[model samples]
Target: MRDVAQPAVAAPAYVVGSGRNATLSPGEIGSFLKFDPDGSGGLKPRVDVPTAQAVVDKDLSSTEAEPKDATFSFAGDAATVVPAVTGRTIDYQKTFAGLLDALGKQGDPTPPTTFTPPPVPPGGTRADPPPATGRAVNAVYTTTPPKVTTEALQAIGPATVIGEFQTTGFAADSGQNIKRVADQVNGATVKPGDTFSLNDFTGPREAAQGYVEAGIIEDGVPDRGVGGGISQFSTTLYNATYFAGLDEVEHKEHSYYISRYPAGREATVFDGVIDLKFRNDGTTPILIRTLWTPSSIKVQILGQKRYDVTSQTGNRTNPVPAGVKSLAGNPKCKPSKGVDGFTITDTRVLKDVKTGQTTSEPRTVRYNPEPQITC
Candidate 1:
């Protein structure tokens, strides 16, 4: 009986530009491309090698002074002080909890957590393409990707041939002589936080970087004398890395495979453009120690044994042989004068040099016929 008044009317379901503009979907728009933490714009985080080494040394010294307390509750004195001990607790906690949870869920089932985020419209934050400088081209291209080769996995440190492969005919290390000095390094150990800049070590990719007008392989073709054989360092180091179990953050595949390298194992290098980089993520510090005892240069990796450094490669003989499936396209390539235009089926072998034993595994390096140029 008390005020049986009327109710207000309901609004329409669909209204165009009535209040907020209408869109097909109801979701907020943002960057369509996921931002890479390690991408160009992100902070370049680095740990200094010297600083890291100092920290480790200091830690070892302090730990030696501390007495070992085996009992979990022996004393509440230094539990909070030791970082190593602190981290160990975290590892154990996560592991045991996971194990117990798995055991508990043997028969029973639990509800899963679900999330429904609002939809995002197309084209939000646009990421600009990488710059188009020569170095930039190499930089972007090198980061494209790389395929591992079993042969490369077999050939690693100490056991590696470490040959110079002297490029003699064209001044060996010349710019005018055609052959040029593809690349050079003093073999200084790179510290943590240290960068491997090709331009810094080898100078510009010009005559100064040491090479002259000569027949150099480019895009699978010996187009003429330009930059020559410079890609070998990248390819060689890449092979060593495959066997070393080191991470390959970036690399570039050749337009066409090179016969000298395990087909999928090669990498390219261009001064100020493409550079090889890796981080020593082990808790113990590492050194990029080099030794030039003989004619060949050896790049050695030195670090404390954190985890069992493990490495693997595709079978040199191919885990899945080419005979399993025949390759298509023209098998032959046209050769140029004084240039042997021929295909070199990728053939490689891997060698592992751990403390006790050494093993060699073969791999295949294929070459699509590259037509060399003539004057």
Candidate 2:
């Protein structure tokens, strides 16, 4: 009977300190012991340790927890965040040890003992003053997290359009293909040290991909093919990228001169065979914007402006005679207006706007005459 007694016990419960919602109070939090002496000068305890552990395990199982990170969601111009929660749990092993030790000094006014408190994990956060009406905002966090966090992404600013180019005049189907290709290039982002390919970005221009039959120049002859007019879009994008100070990776001039395109400065593309590409040479990201209308196509390159681009054109140098093609009794041969053959020279001159230093890149282009057809 002397060994059987109610002793002071210890169990830790966590209470919300500040900026938190709920609070907690633990149970009796101590131990009941019945100590007995063994025959071989050793003491054995008849204590219900399992019952003590069960009470804590059930109480702190799911209800008490750690902190959670705040989550953000965006809809149109509005942004919302789910707030974070801080939680607590019990340290079972430490509390059990403390309870056993408390039994050794049990008294009417039980001795003070401490139990180990479970750590509180981090939880979600709240933005100050909420977000402005019709303005997008991100959730704030308590600690410094990775860049993928909402706070980090919201810091990025919009791209600035540094250079732009436009071209007009197209057949209806051809214009649609141009619009489709323009849609592919629009809203594209290129990271620094990365290359952007016209063919790779727009992909194959098959009929399945919404391309229509349009006039195309192939093997020095004019023909109709699917995705034919996208080259005009490519040329527009090429000039825009070039004037934006991006480094040209690959480009091909038209085999024959088209009066609509700028002499010695236009580019053309063939699916997989020919491509237009440029590299983002600056240290920042580049964004492409396209505006396709029934009458004209526009491409704009956006990024931090670094240089002033200026180009020079030399006088038309060489001229070749136009060939004659007789189409007697052939109704299928449409009347082809004669195109004069010529040669031209052009150069891209980049000037550092800050230092007024300049550099030049020259190009020579040759155009073959389109045969004069008689029907």
- lDDT for every model? 0.32, 0.64
Residues 134-227, candidate 2: write the lDDT tens digits: 1111111133332123332122233356778999999898999999988766657677788998888878889999998998754334678998
Error of 2 at 182 (Å): 0.9
- For each candidate, what TM-score against the reference? 0.35, 0.58
> Candidate 1 overall Cα lDDT vs. reference?
0.32
Tell me, by lDDT, which candidate is best: 2
Model 1 lDDT tens row, 184-296: 44222334444454446556656555555545654333345545545654455555444443444666656454445555556776666776665434232232322332123
lDDT of 2 at 130: 27
Q: After TM-score superposition, what is the CA distance of residue 22 in candidate 2 from its true location, in Å?
A: 32
User: What is the Cα-based lDDT of residue 147 in candidate 2?
Assistant: 18
Point to the candidate with the largest TM-score: 2
